[model samples]
Target chain A: MKPQSMGQAVLIGLALIYLASLYFMSSPVWMGFTINALIVAVVALAWNITGGFGGMASFGHAAMYGTGAYASAILQVQYGINPWIAFGAGIVAGAAMGAFIGALAFRYGLKGSYFALVTLAFAEVLRICASSFAITGGGSGLQLRLEPGLSTLQFNDRSVVYTILLVIVALVMALTAWLKYSRFGAYLIAVRENEDAARALGIDTYRIKVKAMAISGAFAGLAGVLYLQVWLFIDSAVVYGSAISIEALIGPIIGGAGTVWGPLIGTLGLHLLGEGAKHLLHNAPGLNFVLYAVVLICALRFLPQGLMGLAARIGTFRKKEDDNA
Target chain B: MLEVRNLSKSFGGLKAVSDASLDVPEGGIVGLLGPNGAGKTTCFTMIAGFTRPNEGTVRFMGQDVTGLPPHRICALGMIRTFQIVQPFAGLTVQENIAVGAYLHHHDRTEAMAVARQVGKRLGMGAMLDRPASSLTIAGRKRLELARALATGAKLLLLDEVMAGLIPSEVSEIVGIIRQIRDEGHTFLMIEHVMQAVMSLAETAYVLNHGKMIAHGTPKELVQDPAVVEAYLGHGAAARLQEGHHA
Candidate 1:
């Protein structure tokens, strides 16, 4: 990784110290939940690259996510492989799958809503495949035994999972920050704005788009690995559900699309909203989804550019004020 | 230097360019003057490699570049600006120019240098930092010229560049075009501004109904019977004749 910027170093140091405090001060359960949020944040941030910057909005991120979950689960359950190795393998598998789908969609000249439909269809296909595949435990699912060891990627202590998740989030955030200033990032933006123009400038827009999708899928896959490690179980419903894909998009949209900080804000807001809904409408099982829809609708209408855009505007406004002062 | 031979493009049954041929030598502005629906734009597009001619060859610097993509053709030192100016709206004027410069240099600093130089050349130095969408029509035209210039193109394909400019602006643009030519750049311009064409173009090609009606020096071109009949009405040519006699 490139040397962290002063701000990034400070932020990462604070995050690390915060994680250290989780071991010394916070309850293990609290750490576990916080880590869960971070994992979701990482996945959402990755998703924003393809859906937001690349302008190829997808609703099948869960397919990759679920693939990771199941790949790791089955590797541990059946092949007797180390969970760490399984995690890496799962990420690769997810990226490959993402590239496959991206190529197929692009090759068939699908774009916009049709692209979204293709992704949605892939999710459903994966879900159905998982349900019918007996080797994957089908509907019965696979649960890992919680062994207390670093090598196993399973621990009796919830704090370990929390720390792991914190590290993953930090890594994902750093990767995204690196990409923002890189040539690939600029090319992706160019491809998004105008494909023909990008092509005219000697950019292979197709390759950039596919690379973005693959990276996003790989991140989602990593998130799935952690999720499976944390919960100790991977069911077809949990891995391949369309809801997981929707959950992935909500954080990025709420945070801001295209900007690094947007997904974090989005994930935090969505999590808070979900928590509030759970507390306020605990008896009504369907109210959480309704609340999610409401928040998304409100976000789309009011904060169309997301909180990051609002923050950037405020930053520029303040900067101007400072200049005048 | 460029040569187009037997270039033909038909859209369905409508012949856009019919066996058109032109050879442009280095270091001169060759004006492509034609009435509306004369397929002047089609010929330009074919030469710029935007569209493939149904049956023809485009030799740029003596290489057959007929069916190559637009960007590859651009990379080989040929660039075109649209008749309708398309300023990348979200980008600043400097950034838009920088994209053109990026074809030659990847270093942002070097691209900025080229952008600054080209911007100053086109009288757009003050507006470089402004967003292109916010520019005036005249400013947009300058941006288009700056962008094309920044591409390091040896030959420029300009289509209707003076369509919206006032007479003063047109004259200024003509001066710039001539100055660029003096600096060793070749130009193929499609223009309806006859006075500018008459002053700036050493050679002129007139098209009518997708056929090459006349090709000669501007002096001979304006005097051609078919050219006068095509541009001026048959009666208007007579009026000119009577006015000259009087």
Candidate 2:
């Protein structure tokens, strides 16, 4: 068997084992934690499309996330639209927002820190607008009517929500894996490494970046919709807060940026660590934030390439040992 | 075929390349000879669409592609290599080459096959899986050339590819360039290595002080009075003449 096929089979087996384990976990609290972690993982994976691969770090992904949440919530509460259709609308709206932001940033050559700042500013503007807008229920926030049904996407069983989150994260992982091996993925890496050289090699870097951003925005928006459906409530502060952006950034940084499994591992590790700290600290209000900051600092200092780099090194070391043997 | 006409560019106060015109016919190797700051690289940048020309037109395969972006020009079958090697340091040598091959081969497998072929041709087959950042300067230059070749470029603009290489390595590169030329690829090279340029280039153009000083065969270029004065000094041209006779 070819190595690629063997690798694929191994991945499939691992995924099956993970799903089976999740299916057996009966604790509601643990399932809720898993669901939250999975949602963050989805956003982080989406962020990686632009930040890690496309080399355009954005600090305002919350804008798209908020757009998705608010769009879905507004459509359902005000217009009585079906929850699933509103969810789809949110994804499309998020993609449009991404395209608009990408077009402006890339067209004007706003790169590096400037591009990051532009995205941050964009999210801040959206937060303020959402806070002032009556249709979104202003700064007090919006709440979805508690209609517990699959059609409404509001589930009475916590396990159902967990399953849906798992499916979404799995789909995102599949997309990320496919992108990591695709020709377009190669182009994104090239652009990230060196834009001029990529251009000389005939890669339309601007278009590639915009396309990646659009896809990233769409997934982030999906995460937002899922968040709303599960929580039944969202405000400008919760959905479009810089905290959301920080979480998105931290997951990829801790696990590994630009790797397929990095965001999932990173998000899971981050949430578990945060939860452990919260429990040990006697439910301190802001202790988890302090712990996360320390973890991020340590990760940056020691594992600059993140955990995936360490794994890659160990793999190489094992291969060397085998050769020597 | 590549034709650059009336190309001119200026930085705030300095004229980098002024009214420089050059041409490379089908299947010919043309060398652009210039001293430091003679605007050889600037001229190449303009022709390859890395920089916009202030006043000129770059006609590639009979299309006026003066202000087009680098990728557009590359898609038109004209690709260029940077003077300072710009390898995708994070990627392996094969992956770096595959980036160029992706222009023609959409399938990852086919692109990688082309990368391997280009790597072997450029003597980088053994180091295909090695990170490009780990390669020596000469290896990086070869990688750059390999990448350009993998793009299936009909017209290649190579900027100082032979610079900073040992004599043996220079000779090897010259041989590869010759082989590529023999395969019917047209190249416009900006080179400082006199011997390699003389032996490889069928025609040479000399630029000095952002102006074209001379254009002829390599032997004829070296013997030109203006070329010698611009490159060396006022009396150096006389000294060169006496040395040549001696």
Candidate 3:
């Protein structure tokens, strides 16, 4: 695939530099907020793998996120496994869940809005089951022990955890960058454009989509694990709710889905917008959502292809002008 | 290189195709001619493994490949281009061809090189960087052929590759097809353009009412009475024969 190119190197370097800069922020509170946004950003990146690249817009990404969170939490609190090991296991469990759901959905040839609805149902079913199960601590959920250390994956210094999270997100961004020009990436895009055409071109589109969903699940699961390590607790409503799923897709949609940098950029941009709304309308908390709706409407209206598309349009414009000159 | 035997397909008892058969010898250009709704595309779908036949077998390169999926059939060196010209609209012309090239060349660079070579061979050198969506109908048709060719498949089943084109464009495609045939690829094409078929096809099969009505040289099929009645109507074949006599 020629993945480890200068572009990927530059991307990872930029990510590390951005994380180093974030460490210098004066307020710890803002750092925590940034960490939360980073976790959501990870989920958005996960969404980009399938939703953007593969054109499988999942409305139930929370199924993977919540599955990861609950799996790790259950392993630590119940089985008494090492938190770090449980974190790895949680990511695997989430990926397996993603693969399982993807196989079933794609097997039945569910696509478009039908595929989205099927995934939504899977997440809803998982939420109900997680709430009912005793191992998950029912509606109250599970909490890890108060022990805080690198071994436990919990950090006394928020910066340590933030750096780790950013590093993981950066690795995923690198992988996404690889997907930009790789053969698999081409297959994914071909499947997205037209599955029949892709098949005729000798691409196993069903397999590619399942793999994309699994990769997306791994990252979404990692995002969940990050949340658990930060909070030391997880509940069905908090983790498996529609809110996380909605948050996961919103970033990619705004920043540009199916691009190397769109998901992360979109997530960060949304959080900044949310913070601005909070400051501007301090008295009315919910009014910010109304403003978000307005911005989202405008974004959809003007930039239908998202931020990366805007960049691409400008790039082609310049290339054309150069040709003219 | 390609053979179909008694292929039958019924879309809920409508009998889209029944007992239709044709064969293309190695390195030959064969045409499948039928009017609209004559089940020509259905026959292509059956051979390309997009649809299974009710009763029949498809032998490509002397191997039975019936009921297989399209991708597997493509990997076996047989690929079909859609009649509607299915291009990955968001991708550039080169990228679109590269998607097919990936079948033979796994490396992106290697595939892109093959895509460029095949695209330019089909006279699409200047359009390589252009987006597939921007191409006109003729460009898209050439793109369709280029993509199938890019797969490095030995046999191509083209469904209406020149359905909508100016006379000059049609002639250009006919020349391209003839050149490709001489380069050792076999072809089974469904074409409504009579001039291109007569000029390019060594043998042509006629389908009417989901049945094979005739199989002969394009000139011979043009004179057959049943084929004339089912396809070209009464006066058209007489006019063609008089032109031949003259």
Best by TM-score: 2
**Chain A TM-scores of all predicted models:** 0.89, 0.91, 0.90
| Tens-digit lDDT string for candidate 3 (B1-246) | 888999999999699999988899999999999888899999999999889999999998999999999999999999999989878988989999999999989899999999999999999999898878888899999999999999989999999888879999999999999899889899999999999999999999999889999999999987787788786676877777788899
Q: Over the stretch A104-202, how does candidate 1's per-residue lDDT look in tens digits?
A: 898886889899999999989988888888878888888888686888877776766666676777688778877754556656765776665555554
- Count of steric clashes across candidates, in order: 2, 0, 0
Residue lDDT tens for model 3, A1-325: 1212344344435544655777676578778878998999999999999999999999999999999999899999999999889999989988988999999999999999999999899899999999999999998898888888878888888878787887888798888878768899999999999999999999888899999999999988888888998988899988898888988888888878887677876787777788877887774765645666776787789977676566554424224322210
Residue pair clashes in candidate 2: none
Give the fraction of reference interface contacts each candidate recovers: 0.17, 0.82, 0.77
**Measured against the native two-chain assembly using Cα atoms, what DockQ does each of the candidate structures obtain, in the order listed?**
0.29, 0.62, 0.59
Between candidates 1 and 2, the lDDT winner: 2
Using TM-score, rank the candidates from best to worst.
2, 3, 1
Off by over 4 Å in 3: A1-21, A283-289, A314-318, A321-325, B232-246
| Candidate 3's TM-score | 0.93
Report the Cα RMSD per candidate.
4.4, 3.1, 3.5
Please provide, for model 1 over B94-213, each residue's C-alpha lDDT reduced to its tens digit, 9 standing for 90 to 100. 877776787777777787788888998888887887767788788888888887788798998888999989999888888989888999999999999888899989998999888898
The positional error of residue A40 in candidate 2, measured at the CA in angstroms, is 0.8
Worst 10 residues of 3 chain A by lDDT: A316-325
